[model samples]
Target: MNWIILVIAGLFEVAFTSCLGKAKTTTGNEAYWWYAAFALTCGTSMFLLIKSTETLPLGTAYAVWTGIGAVGTVLMGIFFFHDPATFWRMFFIATLIMSIVGLKLVSAH
Candidate 1:
């Protein structure tokens, strides 16, 4: 159940980031609404992430949460926002994933 919460929090992280991307693009009243949505998602997801850390080790939780969020954000932007994921970008992202996996393993012990 705790892990479930963590996953949900991570999903929210993605939501907030996507909203942030959108918020940065528009201007006037529309941007205000996007900013509001971004803030709400960020606040709510952060609270859930804190709750998640209650059961998981802090280091492990933080590392996984942030790593997953970063990678997921980039991948999502590529797919949804049409950001370029060239060969170099893919290589770097892959490296990040591997390093994060190592961090998780270390933190598990």
Candidate 2:
């Protein structure tokens, strides 16, 4: 369904962002490879987002998509990029999750 597609798109957004992080840590050919992955994932994410918008409300879809990407990228940062996982950061992430769920529940589709 469109929701699934939207979720995939969001994940791809995460992937692209992660690729950027990876690219930052590398050099020469490896950095180029990561950048290539970034481009591919970014394009795929956009395409899926456009497809999902056909059936999903643009506001809801965009919010959910960015929400997923934000949460996912933060987690990726904590796990992979050594980002600080402070208490306040986790609390806000949880709140963001709640907000995303709230949007889904209130949505008509």
- What does candidate 2 score on TM? 0.98
Q: Model 1 TM-score?
A: 0.82
lDDT string for model 2 (1-109, tens) is 9999999999999999999999999999999999999999999999999999999999999999999999999999999889999999999999999999998889888
Tens digits of per-residue lDDT for model 1, 16-63: 999999988899999999989999989988998999888788777777
Clash totals, every prediction: 0, 0
For candidate 1, the lDDT comes to 0.84
Candidate 1 Cα deviation (angstroms), residue 66:
0.5
Residue 29 accuracy (lDDT) in model 2: 100
In terms of TM-score, the best-performing candidate is: 2
User: Candidate 2: lDDT of 101?
Assistant: 93
On lDDT, the leading prediction is: 2
